[model samples]
Target: MSKKILVILSEWGFWGEELVGPLEVLQSRNYKPVLCTPTGRRPRALPPSMDPGYKDPPLGKTVATPEMAEKVRRLDDPSNPYLANQRSLKAMLPERPYWSDLGELGYPDERGQMKMSYYPLRKWEGYCRARAQAQQALVEEFEALLLVGGSGPMIDLVNNYRVHDAILAFKQADKPIAAECYGVACLAKARNFDDPRSIIWGKHVTGHPQEYDYRDLAGVLDPETGAMLSREAGNPDRWVNFGPPFYTLEHILRDATGPEGGVHGSVGRPHSVIVDYPLITGRSTADSYTTGEKLVEVLEKGLRRYGW
Candidate 1:
């Protein structure tokens, strides 16, 4: 039987190669990938990511090679086999409401202990439990899970509760979980229910570094009004209007991995990927292909250690 992998994409946008590179490796080896999104919508690619010749304003150059650029174009094409017949996340794992009705549960209040009655609170709790259970079952069908990255993931996947639960499921199963670029932030955020610590609380990993961060125009306000302009409209160059990244991936990963865990900043170097048992992380766009190949190794050969 063909190996199956569960692939999650951001609804906003995804870096083209982050999805295509690893996919090429998986498909070449006959590993079937199932695509999913937060709301079951077809994910889009960022404009800069789709154009091979487009100069990254921050990097002052184009990141895609002719060969990889073509791969991205093929994957984005509506006629692409992988995308054309893909299913939604909701379809793969049906989600139900937490509680149909509310009831009085004897629980402590902010002031003291009391029987609290509320709607949606208990239901929300139940929903989380059911959702987590469903995700665990869904993950069991696949050999591994992949979280593709881009600016979009910074918006959606970072704090997505569903994505966190899915990661937890994969971790529990001891299956490989791979992420690229900003997708690595999800790993730093995902934590077990009983523990407040992150999943990578003591693991070494790599992600987009400070050197890779863009010069955010959003950091500065209008000179006269002292008010920020509309991010999409106020700035034409797409640089001076939007706020800078709230957190650097490298710093966040360093903190999440704890003092014992290491955050490898492979910036200014060749492409890099790191494997720490069940977790595989890539630094940036350049690392996408290598990330995929490493994931394949982990799944096929049970690779436990790599690039430090």
Candidate 2:
């Protein structure tokens, strides 16, 4: 049977190449991709991603070539049929929570079980985690889950319990989980509440490096509501600090993987892609194609663990 992959995209805005690069490889190999969103709505590409000449403020270079830009534009076209179709996260939910959701139950007592006391704030975490985990069985429907990245991810994908649940399920099933650029931040945040350590706590990975991050205005849109995604919509500021200038995916991955795990980055090199079994990551937009290629190798060639 042709390989089918579940691709998670942010409703806000995804970097065009981040989606196109890996997708191009997957398409060439005839791998079927099922696009999904947090709310099951169609996702859109960030405006800047379509501009081949768009200069990255920090890198001081054009991030996308004209050829790649055209490809991204085609992929993002509403009439393309791919972006036009999507599945809802709610439809995937099952009954039980994953092992991580237990942490949110009540802070987990000394024995690593839910504490007797109640944690109102944590209740939602527990609920979301459980719902996400129950959907772990959904891994059977696809070979892997690909998290595409862009500034929009910072607004929705990060700390999203459903996304975490899906990642955990993929890990439990030993299916490859691929992510790129800011999308890598989900790994750092996908931790078992009781464990104080991230799922990548001891795994080598690569992500958006500190040097790769830059300050820019990123607008997040709620595909369901057709409005700017904001926390304090009633207030004038309305969570204006959602996307800051200094946040870097590499820093979080480095700390999450702990001192034992390695976070490789291209300081002087042109590209970076790391495959550490079940977790395939890429540095930035430059590594998107390589990231997809690496994922293909892991899924098709029985490759496991590379890219120190």
Candidate 3:
């Protein structure tokens, strides 16, 4: 049987190409990739370009492909236990209502549905809920986990507890946990039971750079907190941006050892890269191919190590 690989997608739409590219790489290698979410329903993909006025657009308007739509639809089956969970689905919904809330300021909706407003960061409630659901899912199913990144992850992945749970579970299982771009933040937030600092206290991993967040012009502006979500999500002491310009250099951060001995994380850029054992990660959308390739590599190596 093909190896079972589980991919967790952000309920908020993603940058269409990011998930698709990596998924294709996995499928080509005969890896049985199963799609799951906080909810099982097909999650939408955000378009490559966002309208200045914030009008949501459907897949038809974006670079989304027919094959990609099929994969999403296949994963969307409401019958799937993952999607059927009410708590997870509710948590996936964005804190702010999509473009409709803009009223007069909203962009013209000549296309199908009004484009939903995409946020750079997720609401704390939504983030927490999804994290919970994802953690549970990882425990019950999946031999390995892959967190595909997009702007949506900026909000949901960082500082989310469920994300921490998933990483910890995989670490405990001694399975490879992989992520790319914003997904890498999941690694950054991992908790170290011994240190109280972070699970990834000493692992090299790459994420959407502070510059990338700044360039995207999509960082959070919390009316309540009055601070950017990214800034709040990161260690206040660290010089990371919650928003964009998304430079490639600072994007790869690493901490290779914890108080305990285990190879934690490594820095990677657009190119394909891998860190054997425990975790595998990539830099950006450009690195999805490498990320997928490395994930399979780790799994295969793991199988050999265990004499499976």
Top lDDT hit = 2
Tens-place lDDT per residue, model 1, 1-308, is 89789899877668888998888889998998888887766676655566778776656789887777777777767566666455566554434333545554443334334434466565455455556557767766888999998877876778877788788889988899999999999999999556989999889899988888876642333323322334554565533433457687888998899989999977678777999989999988888889999999998897998999
Give the runs in model 1 whose Cα sits over 4 Å from its true position: 79-81, 90-125, 217-241
Cα misplacement distance, residue 134 of candidate 1 (Å): 0.8
lDDT by residue (1-308, candidate 2, tens digit) is 77888888888788889999888899899998888888877898876787988888778888889998888888877678888788876567532345434343343333335543245545555455445546556787889989998877787788787788788888888899999988888988986556688899889988877776666554565565434455545535554445444376777888899988999987778988888888999988888989999999998898787777
lDDT of each: 0.77, 0.78, 0.52
The TM-score of predicted model 1 comes to 0.81
List where candidate 2 sits over 4 angstroms from the true fold. Answer: 94-133, 218-246
* Angstrom error at residue 68, model 1: 2.6
Per-prediction TM-score: 0.81, 0.81, 0.56
Per residue, candidate 3 scores C-alpha lDDT tens digits across 79-165 of 545333323423433222232333322221233233332332222324334444555556566668788776556565555555566
Residue 123 deviation, candidate 3, in Å? 25
lDDT score at residue 213, model 2, on the 0-100 scale: 67
Q: What is the lDDT of candidate 2?
A: 0.78
Among all windows of 10 consecutive residues in model 1, the one with the lowest summed lDDT is 218-227
lDDT of 2 at 46: 72
